[model samples]
Target: MSLPKPVMRGLLAKRLRFHLPIAFGLAITTALVFKYTVTEPRKKAYADFYKQYDAVKEFNAMREAGVFESVRPSGE
Candidate 1:
């Protein structure tokens, strides 16, 4: 026998309620991916450059030379 009309409606409503947010979230995520695809390569290159910069001792020396103050540690 078919489900009662109310039961069928309730099931449909419950399914949509659970799935609508997931559908919207996926759509938004897809749009963001497309939008960022163009920028991602440049961002990756900049990140790689920064990683290399952070690895070099000369970068640390330059950063240290510009430091305006040093905080002395009190007795721990």
Candidate 2:
């Protein structure tokens, strides 16, 4: 059994009128929530971690930990 063409069209129009706005609203809300929850926190974490970054100290630490095969140059 199938609905008549006019009834089917009316039902489709009704669904579009109601559900389309709801779906669009939910998508926008979800995107905003994800940005706040994930993107903002990740950016803050990276900024904090790099705020005190030291290059020479890290290099020395890696060298001490046998990460390098070549000896350090006799400049220092």
Candidate achieving the largest TM-score: 2
In terms of lDDT, which candidate is strongest? 2
TM-score of each candidate structure, all chains considered together: 0.40, 0.72
Give the deviation of candidate 1 from the true structure as CA RMSD.
Answer: 9.1
Task: Summarize candidate 2's per-residue lDDT along 1-76 as a digit string, tens digits.
Answer: 9966665647888889999999999999999999999999999999999999998989888877778778663343
Candidate RMSDs in order: 9.1, 3.9
* lDDT of candidate 1 over 1-76, digit per residue (tens): 8965565647878999999999999999998897798678788889889876755476456556664246222332
Candidate 1 backbone clash number: 0
